[model samples]
Target chain A: MEDVRLLMLPGPVPLPERVLQAMMRQAINHRGPEFGAAYTESVEVLKTCFGTENEVFILSGSGTAGMDAAISNFGKGKKIASLVNGKFGDRLYEIASRNGDATGIASEWGTPVDLAALEEALENGAEMVTMVHNETSAGILNPAKEVGRLARKHDALFVMDGVTSVGGDEVLADEWGVDVAIVGSQKCLAAPAGLAAVAVSDRAWDRIVEDRPYYLDLASYRKSAHKEPMQTPYTPAVPLFLGLHESLMMIKEEGMEARVARHHRMSASVRAAVAAWGLEMFPQLDEHSAYSNTVTAVRMPEGVADADVRGTVKKMGIEIAGGQDHLKGKIFRIGSMGAVSAPEILATLAAVQHALRKAGVAGVGDGVEAAAEVLNP
Target chain B: MEDVRLLMLPGPVPLPERVLQAMMRQAINHRGPEFGAAYTESVEVLKTCFGTENEVFILSGSGTAGMDAAISNFGKGKKIASLVNGKFGDRLYEIASRNGDATGIASEWGTPVDLAALEEALENGAEMVTMVHNETSAGILNPAKEVGRLARKHDALFVMDGVTSVGGDEVLADEWGVDVAIVGSQKCLAAPAGLAAVAVSDRAWDRIVEDRPYYLDLASYRKSAHKEPMQTPYTPAVPLFLGLHESLMMIKEEGMEARVARHHRMSASVRAAVAAWGLEMFPQLDEHSAYSNTVTAVRMPEGVADADVRGTVKKMGIEIAGGQDHLKGKIFRIGSMGAVSAPEILATLAAVQHALRKAGVAGVGDGVEAAAEVLNP
Candidate 1:
């Protein structure tokens, strides 16, 4: 069989073989004991991964669905302060604004979130404040903990979008005082895309006035998940849950600290290689700007079209992502989230250098050496 | 390996090996041409399965999520007349009521929908009517076509819960004049649970006033689906779509008419075996009542405990279902949804007979013989 393309996109990450096999297991009765055990274990494992003892519900949708649950459950009729620095952050603001009265603290694309502006918004009349822990669109990590502390100071509940960071970064959900933290299975979990996990604190639950949408009703999810045979309110994506369970087990085996370090190592390696290739980083390159450990965004080289680079990479049986929305065609992103390792990262850097050379770009100084410098160090 | 338990539950039907392998296929870039082709093909196949030339969108949640999209998209502030005869139907009413002004036309759980009552409600200033094509909780098929005709007569859009009937039985969405029909992946499609499909008519799309609840926003789904590289508004469950695509291909191979016939045959055989075992069929077993072709509800014998029968069958490596909600402990259901065959049906019946006999029930007839008669005939 031909080798499968390396999936280095922000999500739907290249799944481990065991996780894939878990998804291939025979169907089980969702209402039966087998599924009950799986569901119960999945919730516990997800909480452990999120670093929270608060309530977490595994939902049968994408990360956006988790974002919807967080916003719709507590944002309706409430004063919401949303921080927007990238596409996902914009989505958080959009979801909240659609549901209730929301004030957006907007930041320029590719820029770090302004905590002072967020604090000002929260100090107004905001009851809930939303922020993305890692913004994939900009390849930057937001000041989630700082935002959480500010929200707490202003008596506003903090809802965090940890879609790309929860399992890959040091996301201390409870310690950071986040009321709701949302993540997707396909991100750092190394599972298939289809499941979203939402960690809800008592504060977020208490703010739910009524059930808005039936399918995404967090109150119902909490009630059902607390049952003896813990389960979601509706029929879950059983195979996806199985994949997640296996992925979480793999994470447990790796240990959270090791996983986070591995991700940081890969991030540093990618950034070094991009620098060696003489390409500008998309997000501000500074200590305060906070580069993402999950994905690295680099500006496209002059005279090298984004499509040509991506097309060449695809021909080499590797897949990465281009910039999204307004940043499309301006930058290319290399995602090292989930099951990605040093070998895969080195291979990706090599392929991009080859693609760049083919596009007549010069000064692509030994990509492998640059990446190994950080990976070995 | 030990034989897996026979998943004879309504949803999460035993997946074919090809479908399972398709799910195990490596993740593809959601924005790439590969997923675009898959998405476009899936939409076409789903349209074929629903027998509709109307618009179809693949969503990343349970059937309940599809129901939400249908109601939330068009039912907000519109007078809705919802027909409720079972749990799912009641859920439809609840979803619609939460979104808009709705009046429910309630019916006995195990009885068919009262079309006259629905018509009367529609005539009384109702702008939309919702009904379930097959109510799994009650193991009965509602008169959806009749209700659709009545809804049309009253100038009301008809939304249907085709969750259990879309692929298992006859569901001609366009011919039945269904403005919107919702189905789940795990049900008759024999795909893993995680995805929902909504087939919407022009009328339904025209009625969407505002995009509320960002994730379930149908307008956004339509817009993205119409793009060059067709895609979901959010990250879709890619593996589930792959499995569904394979399952749909299998359905196409079997031909819809033959598939429907096989489901009917299995339903008849299960009903016959129950009768031969001196068990009464639930859901007002009558010609007019239209028992579900996908699942059959059987009353528990006087001396037999529900758990005892279910446990015995489970021990024999088979999994059937007990009644849900109000019918729990009173009736048990035998599901013959996708991929079920005569041998499996006969084995299930024999196991049930053995369980009944073990429960101190006397004169347990040869259930295999009864089922064989229906299968062989």
Candidate 2:
């Protein structure tokens, strides 16, 4: 790597200097007043980032922590429908089952989870349905709004994983009828990676109260939200939350729609340029690809190794990811993550094409010219 | 608060500048090689700070997180006896009952959790007994060695909360026969809060593997720990862990025994001054009156408001805690947490005397001089 600060790859994307400063600022007493002010304000910002009016609880863990809390509290004694089409989708299903909720779903890599099948599964009277808004594993964005609507119609709680979608996509937690939503500081939020957040609707809140484990419980966290300064039931990751506060403000300043649009613009250009290079688009359903502008997973041509492509491109400080699990070596993922611009995308595509040619892949033609045309056009 | 960059209420004690800088170091990819280095080194430091030869697992939440994990993992499918004598001890009971396993026996606040009662309670097929080494709530130190032997004799897991004791007192986790010992980064440890640790012996590890709850499951963390550049199974308070690493190094430089002595010297001075001032200690047990080096709870003179005294001391930029729960209005808890010296203790005693007298309590002679003489003699 040419530079130590790698902005690419996956989560924990390069943070803004201000966010680092916030995390570096003197650590505060998680229970004290100063930290409470920062934590409480950070919660407010997280609520706005998720586009919800409900209380937000920031946990001092990764995105998985929020996912665990959501299902454990609300999914107790209730069936949960998990929509799995990727690695993180499996993660959702696993955590749900681990939390004592029953989960069985059908999904295939590189394809959006079948909503029709999910509806059929809901016949068993699931109390909640968990789905990843952006399935980072396969680089596919599920039809969340439609799935959420279906979940509501079935009277099941709709818990959405917005880990990869929150900052890069226009996610309206309230409008979409999402009862519980999970988000992380890494990914498109461009903050340090330790903090995870959740926004709960009244429906989910009721379930939380009815079945709450003291440690993972959200009822107390919600009640304590308004009354006290943000004292975590435990000592929290104080510095990460402060950095999250700054990141949310930056997101708000850009306006959520504007931020999402910027991502769309870059993702579109990358898709267009990659197509011109004759690489197959891995996301099966094309028109339905309203993906979070953060990442795009593409199928590698026959004999062009995913590792070779990622390795060579990384040499130019443009890090990319290879598919995980079954899809590994079959596909590559390039991110239009935080601060990725038109020029950067154009440069990255050129670098990828060069790498493919270096690996002895034939039919690599005028990739830079195509990227330049996509950028200017 | 005057032109200070940060104001910590004594601790989540004041974080050293170097500690803050270290914590701010960019977040390393948890699965990456670099994180393995950090994880391994941190575990070593944690062992040193905890005064144990066993492997230490760093949980992401607060000190209570460790308590909950300890109780859940150690006493799975069995009952646990808990010696409750303070606010924190009550927390141990709550965590014991929070989920998975464990039953507890608790005593009233300001008492030594009656080791005799605990011994009897262990016979009810309780598999583990949890106790707080330093009850921050009532400012009393439970006889940990005695409790350890009592629990081990009964073949019960001996778990202790060292949140307020580690740096201030000798917590020989191994020598004391503690199967699972928990500690936080605040109070006597003299570090910023958020990180909590648990040292596990071979016996405890077997229990952790046998009964696991996924998230609080320390075995998975240990597996990932063995893999290089320190990695946590989940996202942790990255910055706080960095601060903790630095703070651990500092504790070593001071030498653990000397640090322990410093706390005792300060404790002796506080007790002598209280006696000279004719103020009674909160603990009813005499030997318990020896006190924790970090804190002491003193009964307010009849009719003197604990809040009033604490509020006045806080105005002078020295914040002290009022008794929690029922003890709220009855007594004042003065703490000598983190890097506290004998002179600082003398200054605080002087301030306490002034605050007490101003709140309409008549004191016996010069309190500061009395404290100094107690230390010198």
Candidate 3:
């Protein structure tokens, strides 16, 4: 008896059987032709998926490693401006501060980053600017394009943490003037949680100095990628690469335009269910901030402890995430990203409704019904 | 319809079906109690496997990342002596050179590190000494215990890269005075590639200072591992962790002593087969330079091209490794690590014999017969 739970976290989402089967395949030599072809193909697919013609590399680590790469590659001795709207955004700032001279343009957790504050930091002689496309912690999608424009205007390199956005949202890395865009395999890619894909622009490459961290060295990645048969500087997580290749193929088959549309539709349904449940969204849903298409952060109702809400759902073989950092116990998050279906979303909503009611909450109109209205319509 | 090849390479060796199945398990929340329990259990198992009471932490990247961690954590502004006998030893030196002042006590490939040389380097006021236990690139097992002793005598932290040795070889971390021992999952652990486990002694912990690479920061790893329920500072490779847990369980069931004996037996059989085929061993078989019990390096016979031999064997659904760097084309390697069996070793020997014949370089007696003698008597 396999007791499978709904994986509704921001990452490590439910992987397809095909992807898992790919991962189960025998490992190939990292320097061999087999891995070379796979690496080259995967990089090309990732470039297409991220909407960037820049150099893309797959690192054998989590998204945070990619973030570190972004920061360490160009952060040294540079005045970096990090836009912080949520936990992940703050992490970028923290990483920048540790590796470089960085000034954080902080914002309220549930609000989008202020554009003027970022511009002011850049004007104050910041050489690079880092922003998170989707703040999974607060369930808010920051204005990446608007910020990118400011970064370009100030002649600063623009780095985007697209970990929770690239695959599920509209991330035109090149079009948005993003010099570097980083994504994780486990997020919307629906592979596993071991690989991070980072696309670096030519401009960013030009800015990269020799003092980069060896493990996170972009030039090494570039040289390896440029090899006739692509390779990594070190032994890669081969199974993760195979799984990512499968997931990227799936993304290609689904087409990025259709994939983004489907995410929009599914996320809308979940938001409708939340609205029907009379729960407030954690991030302010306004013109300035876009609600994350991947995860929905909902404020917990009075008397309903966040743990009880998540625990009850877990009892029903469904997993939802709770808030991080300062918002802990005050909000719960439902991630509807990566290979999630309408039926699965409806079942999750029904389970959430039951969980909420069991946690001393009432008067929530049938959540599933509300979601169905959006799905069918 | 199983077209399985003999995965006779250094790592990513043939994994048991149970380990593959464990890796197939659905994703779980990283911050959940389930992962915490799993992390705690895996760390304890790793400590036992490593033959140490030191604090162990599993990283999401490859063994190289662990090497980076070891160098960056303690080598900051400190003088480090790297005993280089092979490619991996040089890597440790390179890592140290980038992060700290490092002196390389270099030796020829396939030669065991000279204890006197290492002691001399340590005597030069070096604060740390790094070396590889089993040099996968050269198939030479360095005298780690002796080197560790030298390091201890000089009051230098001993960092051991046990990537190809930990699970299958005798690695008495504490007994050998190894302050830091790093191992990867894919090597002798028989798990998929991705995760690296590092055990740190109290002496090494005291030497850790700030200004280390952010991602490889040991203090963060220690703080997370010491959590009420163990955790990683960043998102870990969950599937790899699950696979490692299964592999660790397999190690426990087999008993470490039995496992190491089995590896020694298998590697000896392969070496015997190579001798029967009249192929010279790559590394000098002497009292000092011990051949690896994981991978056996065989010098190619005259007129027998390395690729031709490997290709011929691969045509018979067997995969062996060619040498790396300068040693490439000069030697071929047969890996007998992890979950390999007696039958598999015999088949590989037979395949190698046939391949050598096909390469027009065979006047040697039955290789399988030679290996069988070693296996049986």
Candidate 4:
């Protein structure tokens, strides 16, 4: 019998059974009406999730592909300000620097972006601003609205990496003045990994250049999408698209407002459990920063090895994520994104509590009960 | 009841049952050993399909992504001679011209590349050469070996777009001195569309530059693939990778030689049917160039409308391809690639014959019988 392992990672969250079933169908002609319907429907749902009336296009790559397209299309050869607070933030900075003349406005991991520095950069001729809405690496949700305001004030094009936020959290792209926003299928959308959906404001479209990478070119995508029987500029991952369509339908069934609320409740339960366990949360939040509603990061207790807790939980068939890069072994994250519910959250919490007690962590409390109370309440 | 349609287009071919089943599994951790093992196995099989000992990397985009990477990585800022005889060949030239100082060596559609033009460009200091191995658009297999030889003679790098050829046709990348070879999953591999495999020779690797697109960077793919658990640089389209793994395994089970022979026999049957129907083959092959074994393009009969023939067949639950771009309505294409066998071929031919007869075409013969004779013989 196969071990039914629970995936509790930040992205690539467990898919719904219907989404998996949708992917099992035989191949369909991508240039035909059936695919066109699915593609157009997915784009419609994506626009709602992005909270934008702007044009949205799907790319056959990861979230990074969407990020690359956003920057390369509108930010290339321009002065840009990139904010870095965690792994994904740094990735945006790197991609921005590679494509344009970018300046990194550094902030500590799990901390708020340096607003003064961003304003300084923008005032000093930064033509674009790049930011990560939800930093999954540190489980921090950055202030996208504030940053968008600053960018709008400076008359700079704003590109937001909403990979883990759009479908699971609140993201009003047009209201926030975001020129471009990106989301990954495997994150809050509850679809399998690989597809990236990007929304582009008319402002960004007017400024987008022609000299860009062929595969990630946004203009080509727009052109092909407007054709009869809408299609991608290149061949899409057909199965993944099918899965995404199904998942997006599910999202529609459970309205985006309800889904975001569920995510908030789930993450709050995990935080309640962490507080009950006498464990500290990883991210130190400021007024403009908050705990991510998709994933909760908790610092490793004193004298407890990361392997002892995370490995022990893994042995019990529950998989969580350890800290990446410099924060390795210092923290563990529990994802509450996608279609995750009370049952999965409770099961994961029970396993984590058992592992923590088994690892001889002193003063361990009833974390599961605390989590259950939050769930029931 | 849903209509069961047979896809006879050049790509997004009908997937095998096992491949679809493989893609139905729930998402797994992409950074874990399970994904690593699957990715490693897929790469090993891709090497065999590509017919090279050189390193192969799987990308999460379409075949165009591979083409973009192949050109932008090594051909940027260099002098490139792009051979254009079909739509795909024109695409290569377009991409090359966008990235490098490229010159398109042109020929009419459904005809061989102009060798003299290519030679002149090489003699005038062209540093790289690009050709499409199997031009799916025109159903003509370009002379990759001859083009590779010419490139080698001039000490230039050779890049072959083997998108529709590598798995089902003969593509000896190393022996042909191809510096870079790319294949599409949906073409000959019978996998879902969206994944592309690229095999890169060391010579090309040595010439690859740093200043290229971030998402399609080959160096990043190489670095990530070499890590402990083999992985793509970014989050891969996980379900497509699973489907590709199953399809590649099926190819290995059938053996490349047997697969190529099957493709040759199938396409020969298609050609045989065209001859029996008193229709003309579209491409005028040169001494070196030959009709493509993956797809067969046939000129539409005089006084027969493309919509009348193809649309009628499509109404009968069958799908064949019409000519692209300028060739639209001038010819029709039949794909005999992927896992197609006698049943599919016979059914498609029967429908096409019925459509043609209904459209008032004279001199129509028993094409199904002719195809069956070739299939059995």
**Candidate with maximal DockQ:** 4
TM-score for candidate 1, residues paired by index: 0.97
DockQ of candidate model 1: 0.69
Residue A91, model 2, lDDT: 81
Interface RMSD of 2: 3.1
Q: Residue A142 in model 2: shift from native, Å? A: 1.4
Report clash pairs, candidate 4: none
Which candidate's lDDT is highest? 4
Task: Give the per-residue Cα lDDT of candidate 2 at A261.
Answer: 81
Q: Rank the candidates by DockQ, best first.
A: 4, 1, 3, 2
Per-model DockQ: 0.69, 0.48, 0.58, 0.75
Interface RMSD of each: 2.6, 3.1, 2.8, 2.0
Lowest-sum lDDT 10-residue window in model 4 chain B: B1-10
> Could you tell me how far off, in angstroms, the CA of residue B24 lies in candidate 4 after the best superposition?
0.3
Local distance difference test, per candidate? 0.87, 0.75, 0.87, 0.93
Compute the lDDT of residue A285 as modeled in candidate 1: 41
Query: Which TM-score value belongs to model 4?
Result: 0.99
Docking class of 4: medium
For A204-241, candidate 3 gives per-residue lDDT tens digits of 88888677777777788888877767898888888889
* Interface RMSD of structure candidate 1 (Å): 2.6
State which candidate has the highest TM-score. Answer: 4
Q: How well is each residue in A1-377 modelled by candidate 1, as lDDT tens digits?
A: 23347878888788899999999988876665677887777777788778999978899999999999889888887899888889998999999899889988888877988777777777777899998989999999988778878888888889899999999989999988999999999999999998899999988777786847789999899898878778778898999998998998899899889999999999999999988888899997445558899999888887789867887987898888898888888899999999889889988999988998888888877877899999997
**Candidate 4 C-alpha error for residue A307, in Å:** 0.8
